[model samples]
Target: MTNDIIPVILWCVPRSVSTATERAFMGKEGCRCWHEPLGDPFYFSSKRQSLRYSEEECKASGNWDKDIVDVMQTLLDPEANNVGTDKKGPVKYVFVKDMAQYIIPRQTLEKIHKGQGSQCYRTDGETCGTSRCTGVDSEGEIIENPTVIPTALMRRFKHTFLVRTPTKAVPSYYKCCQDKMAGFEFFDGAEAGFEELRILYKWISNPRSTFNTDKEDGPGAVSFPGKAQKQPLPPPLIDASVLLANPASTIKHICDQTGIPFDPAMLSWDAKPQAEFAKWGAYHQGAENSTGFKCEDDGAAKTNGEEAKIAKLPQEVRNTIERNMEPYEWLVKRQTTFA
Candidate 1:
């Protein structure tokens, strides 16, 4: 049952054009698209209460855990849904674009896959007699993975990750929450102030990370002093800003690590339809009346004298974006070095 499912893992910070990028891949040839919104895609909604199987369903017959295992198998393989969606070409590659939230904390995910994938993490209160959450122990205090779905079953799936810039991500996120590009109420008070949001910007901009690990995000993120720590904090998941800033260098970075050819189209939507502008309305509620970066769509427009607002941001946050971007600036300067 192993189909052509190519797990196109979208490792991205929120507001990093993930939805747009996914739309591009789905529009490609022979790729099946499934949205792991929050986590579960296809059947279960987020309001999903939990395991609803009776004792017989759990033990004697096909158990909840076993059932999920089968479903994961189907998802990893090819599906009719992915075939010929692209009128321009024949379908062969099946793409599954989702966030790394599926594998929060990393170690837990690795443990699950160690054993055919466990359904313990996917338990609902009814089945496991507990809340619909998987407790994760990190830094000491235990917290729910927040986004852990049917993990044991889908643990082994692999996917490609897309990363982007932090500074741009901040404004974009603000726009989304305000409803310019497609945001949710959860974003309410998302950017109460520029300084506060700047710290958040650095958190999501870790570049090396892309999934929400039990709300494991959000701490006052100030810039690294560049003062090499006694041991240098582990680099972020993947320096997304690094990629967006230097396409040529990004090309080599991807090849050096994954051996995949860099398709220029990966950076920008080539077939972006004019009507797609309206699609923003579907995801964002407040976008109907925003100016430039305030809206989810067409945020590329520069603001009139927004520089006056820079000082409004906390010095720590302002410094993070600037200092972090310096490496990219350096790379651009050495253009002759990039492939």
Candidate 2:
């Protein structure tokens, strides 16, 4: 069925004000919002099992992948939910906030192999898997097949990336987990980092390239599928620091990019947190406490001090921050700037 609602997919790292941004979108007229529907699969994946999350948590949250798929189908179906009647205005947006790392890499690879809008490196009819990356093959020649994003998902939304400097984000994230999870060990760059964000951005910008091909190849020049039509621009990148500096303006800028009207309701919300957050409130206390985009002077000062404390972090943490700098800088350059 035809519908005007735009699907807004927000990709963010932890502690990047992603929850707050989701709340802002919730306040907007004709908007339906969702938290990390993708979090469970990512947390349960083999790569992340020993990191910030635990298997016990995964067992408690069964079938997370199915949950996300159902939610996505609902959001995409114009006739599935009566979205327009919930607010005075006709529903025109579905705002979903998720982490870049939350996308299951293995699943994405599988879909690409099935030709779910993904291209790949092939020689003699042997399509390469995730291991086939950009670099010298045994023949000593450069193989440059880029890992395209899964088009089945990419075509579903106008994506936006929310980023923060590693110095500010990493410490804040570690502290959050420490407060919530008992005996949580300090994670290095491999566990808590911006590499996933960078990887996702590359795929989004070059969705026509090979999926799971290689992260290093980046978005090599590729033609959009439809002949002669202009390709859509890559998702907008919003810096948390920039958004916090001027929340209203930054949100408006983002809305414009996503083809949605800027609603004043997005600037504020109820003093109490919404019922929707109950399922994950433990991990989202900061957003729950905020009533609006306006940052208090004292709060701002405290945050600045906390950010400054990054220098005093342990050596391993410092090293992780350094490792994250490359990708963080890449996204920062592409972020939406406010005057």
Best by lDDT: 2
Tell me the spans in candidate 1 whose CA falls farther than 4 Å from its real position.
1-5, 19-74, 80-84, 87-90, 100-147, 150-152, 159-167, 180-186, 189-236, 248-261, 264-271, 274-339
Residues 1-339, model 2: lDDT tens digits: 346567778888887888898888887777777677665445543333223455565555564234443445565565643443456656667788887665635333332223222121111233435542332345533233222333443455677889888877877766765575323444434445386676666656554443323333234213212111122465678888778878888888888888779987788887666666666646676688888765534378887886678778876667767777888998898776555
How good is model 1 by TM-score? Answer: 0.44
lDDT, candidate 1, at 157:
34
TM-score of each: 0.44, 0.71
**lDDT per residue as tens, model 1, 1-339:** 333233334444455445554554444444455544323321132222222223443344223243322334455444444433444543444445444433232233223223322232342222322322234244322233222333222223333345444455544454454553442322321111222112222333232323223122233212211111111111122333444456445544533342234454444443433232342345522222221121222233443334445446445435544543543333223222224
Clashes of each: 22, 2
lDDT of each: 0.36, 0.61
Candidate 2 Cα outliers beyond 4 Å, as residue runs: 1-3, 44-56, 64-71, 79-90, 104-149, 181-189, 207-232, 294-308
Question: Worst lDDT window (10 residues) for model 2?
Answer: 221-230
Q: Cα RMSD for candidate 1?
A: 14.4
